[model samples]
Target chain A: MLINHPLLGPRDAAEFTCFGDASLLLRPDPGPNGEPDQAAMDAFHDYLHLRDNPAGTHQELWYHEQGDRSWLVVTRDTINHSIIKVELARNVKARNLKTREGAG
Target chain B: MRYSVFSILNQALRGNTGWKPVWREPEPRPAYDIIIVGGGGHGLATAYYLSNVYGITNVAVLEKGYLGSGNIGRNTTIIRSNYLLDGNEPFYEMSLKLWEGLEQDFNYNAMVSQRGVLNLYHSDGQRDAYARRGNAMILNGADAELIDQDRVRAMYPFLDFDNGRFPIQGGLLQRRGGSVRHDGVAWGYARGADSRGVDIIQHCEVQGFIMEGGTCVGVETSRGPIRANRVGVAAAGSSSRVMEQAGMRLPIESHVLQAFVSEGLKPIIPGVITYGAGHFYISQSDKGGLVFGGDIDGYNSYAQRGNLPILEHVCEGGMALMPAIGKARMVRSWGGIMDMSMDGSPIIDRTPIDGLYLNAGWCYGGFKATPASGYCFAHLLATGEPHDNAAAYRLDRFRSGAVIDEKGSGAQPNLH
Candidate 1:
């Protein structure tokens, strides 16, 4: 499988190290006072352990270890090794924050 | 028919045509007392124990494919009770004990081999860790021996002991640990359950749960709806998908674990040997092929095949352990989907949903845990209580901060 990096065209998947679900990017917040109450602990536990774990399309984090050293958010099919899209994780995080702010 | 010397002799005298199918291809009934999902080793064993021990013969084991089609037929076939944790040691030791008398108990020739399993340690720190684990095993009533480099060499002289990098210093041996015929386990359990009037239904895919309010009453299958008083899901890799149908989300990720077999050669490795420096375990099959495997492809995937990187990594580990293995041509390789849990341990307990039970999150170790997993799961279904051996395997442990993480790799499925 070749991951089409945003900076580098298409690199071998072996050159990249996968760090599982992109959901790890959205870690849960402890609270305003940073005290881990029951609700905060529950959210953190779910965030750490629970997963969608779908069999179809998945957005996962992949590091270009042997390549340009860029962390890319690769949208790939879990059933077949097909790369749908790849983008910079920083841009994805920024967009996520913007969406959350807009919703708030 | 009872499988014995008399049965073999009688079949031989009758020109070998008197043999019948070991299990029946029965149609699904309208209802059963209990329904077990996934006809893998664990599911079949659960049915076998339910009938033989619990007297719950009105059970049905539903399978998407044929029996033993999952990791039951895909693993490296190594069995051991060399666990370090208090939560996991007793459970696996129970499974190992069941494995010892499994063939005789089920009346089938499973070829259960009791050759020892050795885990080699390279560094002084590693040796100390193995010593601690050995003590833990002994405390848990399982046999363990910490052997030095010379003893390890005496057992297998072909090892790269004096190599510059990752030199073998010592090993932890479990004398009773070994391998079993993987498919024979599934077949024996299926036959045992079938003989006791349990329905073993193949090609019966469970589409969704027949839920009434918040309670699970039955299942909607590919054939039709089959009602049951209680439902136990023993699906290993497909746990998340199967439970999702019941409006439940599990802390599981499906990852592909690959295994390989080399061309048939003379017996060299007497028992299962593991490289502690790297992730590789190997054993010689009865058919002379060297069966071995390493870590799972560290990613969430439903694909039942792994990548070339892990394959190369496994071979490299094998070569590092024993250079002689570099000459053996790998004849076949296959992959199994593993249901990686957050705690790196299994869950065998009642789900929050009424009349629903879960026996999943076996990860890559489901094959070895088959008999005990079945026995405990059947106990739960029959008596509505977690068996003493599997009492700690609660579904709510993650929320309760009681995760039984043997590797101490918290919440990382791939790392486990």
Candidate 2:
């Protein structure tokens, strides 16, 4: 409901967080069409995920008000909650979207 | 607020049990202002709307069989407005609104259970699709949310969480989707309409159209010929055949869909869950049994009975998804032939023939669509114009190759 849409909540659009793991950017979604400069940010981007963040290195959280019962995929900064990318769960789905954070 | 859609629909069914005759032919009326064949939910609903809303009281509903004994009785009652396309989204949302207030409107209960429906996704691509659907649901003012495996586990703790052939990835939750008593909806409308002086003609099997020149003047039925200015064919399975006899060939497929219920399983499934990736869904009835169903027999069939394939396929899907349900014994299963359209959507528009109306091709989603279907069909019959959403379900869409199929996988309901 905010013009800037800063505060993400349960009723807003989906918010996905990815911390560090940037492999998703390289994994050819648009295939040959998405020719990223071959040099992009592979550095750790703080992401927020409730429990299990799909990848081993990427820790993240996803929230979606406009999503199938499944949370849509999102790329955001974990520290500041700054959203980077938002994708449908189908687009970035890898097994389950999350698991519980173990002993870490 | 005290009652949901399913709760409302169920109460109506209980109040009007056996209010209608099993089978009787129709008597020829000198001039019935309106005649609606097939006393299913749609027919009864149309009659009620015409009398109450449009002030058209000289309505006559001619039914070949008992009321609600067709698609109304055989359908697996699942309702939601989570449509991705323009054609289905709004119409279904409208239907949901009608469903929300049917109890107070009819002064009868239809016991609509707003337990919410979940469409599960197995892969990331499917997750993305659900994400979009969730957005569409919210945009359309439907209650929806997306949940992951851990959340699903918290919600449905009894489910088998072990990873398998298709592990639980995520699901699109439609908090507004749910179930209703199928028969209650039909009889409630029938009684409500009958109270308004609308003639209820049962056992009146529509034989042919008594066309005067190019207009539909009346209908020739098994009992006798009845003259009517406005004729609506709401016959479920016989929709295509009735249209064909009327000199029109429609793009309708007469296919049978079945529903199943297992012997009481101690309240397992709390709500309705439709597997988006799988072709099965199960919900626990109030009696502790699991009332469930799956996709139809892929081929076209008019038989009231279905083959073993659908039953087996549904059971397998259920078992694969919910491992604990394996022990539950299949109690009973029944089939109802639906007027499956070229596209999985419905066709609720006026026919080319003047004064002749068509309200068929609901496919498997009719139960959820009953109230809206009736509302839209009534508007079309009264004003002789398509309701806002019926514009998409034009009969010519089939000819034009413009199908508004929702299950983009193209498997239609059969593949669902």
Candidate 3:
């Protein structure tokens, strides 16, 4: 699979280290409760371990280990192994954080 | 009908018309005492044990496709209990013992062969690790033997012993570990369960779970809504999707694992052999085809197919282990979806929803763990308590920091 890295252009999938499901980026925060309550702990556990492993359109994390030291979020259809979108994980994380902050 | 020589002779005399269907193709009942989604080997075995052992006969096993159409029939068919962890060794050893008596118990010719399984080591460190694993297996009342390169050469001299990259040093052998007819396991369990008055419903796709308050009462299937006092889900690859209908996310990812078979050849491989340097494992089937497989496709996917890169990687491991098999033509290849968990172990515990039990996260080891997985899952469903052998397979173990990390890969499902 040719994953078009955000920084390094198109690179073979062999050059990237595959970490499954870009949902992993949405880590649950330790809320303002001084100490984490039971609900926060459960939310954190789900954030860290739970996943939506769909057969079609999935966003996953891939690190360009051999090409460049950048983590890329690639949206691909797992059924036919087709790439749909590619972006820097840092940028995606920042954009998501900004959106959440703006909403808050 | 009892399948004996006399029955065969009687059927032969009567022009073979006395034989009956192995299992009834029943329609889904409106209600059942228990409903088991996914009629694969594990689900069928669970039904069999529930009816026979626990006397819970009012069970229905719903299948989306035909029996054994999932990973149960798609694996390499090797069975071994050579594990290093206290959490896995006893369970798999129980499975191996159950496999030994499976045909007798079910009255079917499932062909459970106990030709030894050997995991070769290429380095001294790897050998040490295998030694530790063998000791653990022995401590768990399972048989394990450590042998040097000479003994391996005596067993199979065709291996690439002199290869500088991964020279064969030693191996750990489990004498009782071997292969079984993969499809026969499902059929045997189905027949056994059917005889015990459990309904085996094929082509019944489960659409969603029926939740009453906080308890799972039944399922919405393609046939219609079927009520049940308890619901057990043994869906292999679609565990995440099926559980999601109940608004429960799983600590599991689905990945594709491919297996291959070569054209028929003379008897070459005497027993199952695993390459230590890489992930390839191979054994000669009864039909003379060399069945083999390697690692999973290094990505999360529910697709039941793999990429060419993993196929080439598996072939490279095969060539590195046995150079003679390089000339063998690959006749067929297929993929099975693996329900990989965070800690490389399984979960056979009650979910947060009352009366909802889960038996998933088998990953690549599901085929070998079939019998014991069914036994423990049935025990849990019958008594509402985790079986002693499967007490470590709690769903909240990840949160409790009590993960049974067999591979020690640290929360990486694909790596496991």
Candidate 4:
């Protein structure tokens, strides 16, 4: 499998390592002081454990370990392994944070 | 009729024409006392034990396809109880015990070969870890022996003992651990359940759960809606998709695990041997093919096929361990989806939904845990209590901060 890297064209998937679901980017916050409450604990548990392992399309995190050392959010089909889009995880995180702030 | 030496001789004398079908093709009934989703090994075994041990004969096993089409036949059929954690060792030991007498108990030739399983240690640190693991297995009433380098060489001298990178230091051996005919297990259990008046319904895909108020009462299948007093889902790889219809999320990711088989050779490998440095394990089947596999594809996939990267990676591991395998040509390779659970351990417990039970998260280890998984799931479904051996496999354990992480990978499904 070849993952199209945003920085360097398409690269062999062996050069990159996968970290499963892209939801790991949205890690739950414990608190301002890093001391978690009961709700925070539950949020952290679900954040780390539960997954929407869909059968069709999936957005996942992939690291260009052997090349650029950049994390990329790759939207791909789980059934056929066809990559639809790839972007830097930093941009995706920024966009998500902006969307969350806009919602509030 | 009961299969025996007399039966074989009687059939042989009559020109071998009077053998009946092992299981019947039964249509779905409107309702049953219990409904088991997924007619894989664990599902069939659950139905068999429910009727044989628990005497609950009003059961129906619904299959999306033909039986044994899942990981039950896809795994590199090795079974062992060499575990370090308390939560896992006892449960797998129970499975090993069940495997010991499975063929006779099911009255079928499952070919349960107790030729032993060896996990080779490559370095001093790995040897120490194996020693600790072997001790834990011994404490759990399972046999484990930490053998020296000389003993390992004596048993299998073809190993790359002098290789600079991964010199064989020693190994942890489970004398009773070995392989079984994988599909025979499914057939045996299906036949056993069918003889007990349980219906084996094939091509009956469960589309969704029939929820009456807050409790699950039945399932809508490809055939029709069937009601049940209780429902147990033993779906291995499709656990996430199957349970999603019931409005539940599991701590599982489906990944494709591929297995390979080489062309027929003479009887070489005596038992199962695992490469400690890499994720490769191999055994010689009775048909003389070398059966082997490595890690999952490391990505979530419901595709029952894998990519070339993992296949090449598995061959590299095999070549690194046994260089002689490089000369053999790989004949066939296939993939099965694995329900990889966070913390690398399985969950066999009641779901939040009432009257609905789950037996999933076997990951790639589902093949070895088939018997105990079924027995424990059956026990839970019948008595509404977790089996003593499986008490630690609760779904709420994750929420309570008590995950049974055998690999200590910390919520990473693929790493396990």
Candidate 5:
């Protein structure tokens, strides 16, 4: 599979390290009291471990170890393994946090 | 019917029409005391043990496809207990013991061959690690031996001894470790469970869980809704997706691991052999075909097929170890979905839902852990407590900093 690294252009999938679902970027926030409660801990645990594991069109984290060392969020169809989109993980995280903040 | 020489003779005399099906094809029942999703080897074995050992006869094993159509029939069939962790060694040892008497207990010829398994080390550090693993195996009541280069060369003289990248240094041998007929194991367990009054339901796809008041009461199947007092999800690759219906997220990811088999040739390999420097392992089947496999595809996927890069990587490892088999024709290749856990170990414990249990996260070792996994999972479902050997396989082990981490790969599911 050819993953288009945001900084390194197109690169082979073997050069990157896979870290599973991109939902990991949306880390759970602290509780209302600014300290972790049971609900917050449970949500944090779920965020860190649980996954969608979809069969198609999955967003995943891939680190370009041999290239620019940038973590890329690669959207690919797992069934056919065709790349859809690639963006820097930091940009995705920032955009998602902003969107959530605006909605909240 | 008992399968003996007398029965064979009687069937021959009667034109071979008196034989019965090994297991009955039953329809889904309205309710059961215990419902086991996924009628693969582990699920069938769980049902068998629950009915026979725990006296829980009102059980149903629901399978989406035919029995043994999953990883139970798609593995490399290597069974060994050569582990270095306290949390894993005893459990695998118990599984190996169960494999020893499995044929007799199930009344089936699973071809439990005890030819042995040898892991070849390529460096001093790998040799030291093997020695540590061997000592742990011995401490766990499993047989292990550390052999020098001379012994390995004497046994298998066809190896590429002159390779510069990976020298032939030594190996770790487990004499009791071997292979079993993978499909026969599933069939035997299904038959055993069927004869013990458990319903073996095929073509029953579980779409979702039937939850009432935060407790899983049953399952919503493609056939219909079926009620159960307790439900155990042993679906190997689909564990995360299956549990998602119950509003539970798992610390697991599905990745594809491929296996290959060459055309039938002369029996060159006597036992299982693994390369220490790489992820390749090979063993000659009874049909004379060389069965081999390597690492996973390194990506989260639910597809039961692999790309060509892993195939090339695996073959390169094979050529590096034994150059003579380079010309062998690879006839078939397939992939099985592995539930890679965060710590490279399994989780067989109660879920947050009151009536639901889990038996998943068997990365690449599910086939080897079939019998004991079933035994322990059955014990847990019956008594509502973890089994002695599986007490460490809790759902919250990662949070509690008690991760088994047999590979010491940390929390990276793909790395594990």
Candidate 6:
């Protein structure tokens, strides 16, 4: 009888390729349903300050699932599926912090 | 093809849209009886065992991402019960038993193979260690056969068995030790648990934990807050981070570990070969790729991707033993994060915090310990007491210089 390969997992298992930064990468495959979920853009805006930028590096690829489970935005090349920069998909100022900072 | 971090960084610098979150709508839930923190193998299995065996329903396995997307999915899929620690020995051995009956238990074929595992030795001292381990295994009723060079050749002739460098002395053979279908283990648990009223909540992240009078009442999640009588943390790679959110400390270091698989080939390695002399081990995935891995990152890292040096060292050790492997093309490689404790043995005990329990510190052997760990952890949850065997793995042990040093290293590797 023929045996299947080890890497061949179930159909829905998230496929991943590793670059620099982070463990447990679980970013979802984009949906075919047309509209993108723009609800988490602010999360992508100020991720560098949250991630604190890796040593000697400025911009980083941060998929928020490591613990935040918020949103992770990464910049990549269209030609090659490479993660150039990653950040938390959500980066809203905390309500208390926003009030404390006198944003009003 | 998926995007690489390098090109993603380039695009980000050029005002290009890169790494962004794909958010899905949140699903509604009233409340769950038992809520498992991380939806890895142990979490899922606990849910299955909780509902199937204990008859307790209304369970929810909350995963920050899709199921089997964490360390459970990233592991090398090697399963063995060759641990030398107390409680750990019997515990892992029991997991091997559950693996033996998993197809019947979960009604899913996990593809468990008892193809045997050989721990190689280079020097007499190394050979002596295997003897001790082998003797221990025999004493514990495990099937361990000490084989000589001739015996090794008879079993596997393709191995470079001659007067080459790093000469092969002998090996400690665990005839029953082998591998299993890893992701299958995940799905089997998911299906079994789902069928028994266990709601597996995916794309849900647990934010800070909810503490009531120093007892963990429940958790505050990204979706919302959840209340539970008890909570378990089987979050392998994210153990430290998850615990941190609960206002606790864990004696664990997160490190990156990588596994590589070569292109398909004719049969070469018939069984799992562990090079005890170095951080090297290789096994042929049924798909024909030589799946192998090595030590954790020397430095602390939560990053799943490993450095080049470790990948080089692991492959070097493989090439040293199996020279024919030099021509084999490396098809793919990936890495996973591990919450490595000071000692390799895991900690399965109730914390000072009431109703909150920890089953972390799995090191590199989490896959092998899944069933036994889940059973024991479930017992801890139900009775609020650590089993007699697992009681020794307490947080205070790390403080009072009390430890069960199985490998006797007090800390990390050099475990045969």
Write down the lDDT of every candidate, Cα atoms only: 0.91, 0.70, 0.90, 0.91, 0.91, 0.69
Q: Please, what are the lDDT tens digits per residue for candidate 2 over residues B111-212?
A: 888888878888899999888887887787777899998888877876656656788877788877888877878877876787777888877788899988
Candidate 1 interface RMSD after superposing interface residues: 1.9
| Residue-level lDDT for A60 in candidate 5 | 89
Clashing pairs in 3: none
Model 4 regions lying over 4 Å from their true place: A31-35, B410-416
Q: In candidate 1, how many clashes are counted? A: 0
What does candidate 1's lDDT look like per residue over B1-416, in tens digits?
A: 99899999999999999999999999999999999999999999999999999999999999999999998998988899999988899999999999999999999999999999999999999999999999999999999999999999999999999878899998999999999999999999999999999999999999999989899999999999999999999999899999999888898888889999999999999989999888999999999999999988877787888889889999999999999998999999998989988877899999989999999999888888999999999999999999999999999998888889798653353353
DockQ of 2: 0.01
The alpha-carbon deviation from the true structure for residue B42 of candidate 3, after best TM-score superposition, in angstroms, is: 0.4
Displacement of the residue B209 alpha carbon in candidate 4, Å: 0.7
| DockQ metric, candidate 3 | 0.64
lDDT of 5 at B303: 77
Give the per-residue lDDT digits (tens) of candidate 4, residues B1-416.
89999999999999999999989998898999899999999999999999999999999999999999888878888899988899999999999999999988999999999999999999999999999999999999999999999999998899888878999898999999999999999999999999999999999999999999889999999998999989999999899999999988899989889999999999999989999999999999999999999888888888889989889889989988999999999999999998988877888898999989999988888888999999999999899999999999988887887988788663353354
Q: Which model, 1 or 5, shows the larger TM-score?
A: 1
**Global Cα RMSD, each model:** 1.4, 19.5, 1.6, 1.4, 2.0, 17.4
**Candidate 5 lDDT over residue span B315-358, tens digit each:** 99999999977989999999998988888899999998999999
Stretches of candidate 1 exceeding 4 Å from the true structure: A32-39, B410-416
Report the error of model 4 at residue B305, Å: 1.6
> Residues B1-416, candidate 6, lDDT per residue (tens digit)?
12356766888897876644322233626466677889898898888888877777776778999989988898888777776656567777778888888877887668899999999888899888788887777666677888998999888787777636688888989989999889989888787777676788898898877888887888889889888888887888687678877766566655567889999987778899987657788999898888888876443455567657667778888877777888999988887767666666688888778878888877777888788777777777767787665667776566555666775432232232
- Tell me what fraction of the real C-alpha contacts between chains A and B each candidate also makes: 0.68, 0.00, 0.66, 0.73, 0.70, 0.00
Cα lDDT of model 3 overall?
0.90
By DockQ, who's the top model here? 4
Considering only chain A, what is the TM-score of each predicted structure?
0.94, 0.31, 0.92, 0.92, 0.92, 0.25
TM-score preference between candidates 2 and 4, better one: 4
DockQ of 6: 0.02
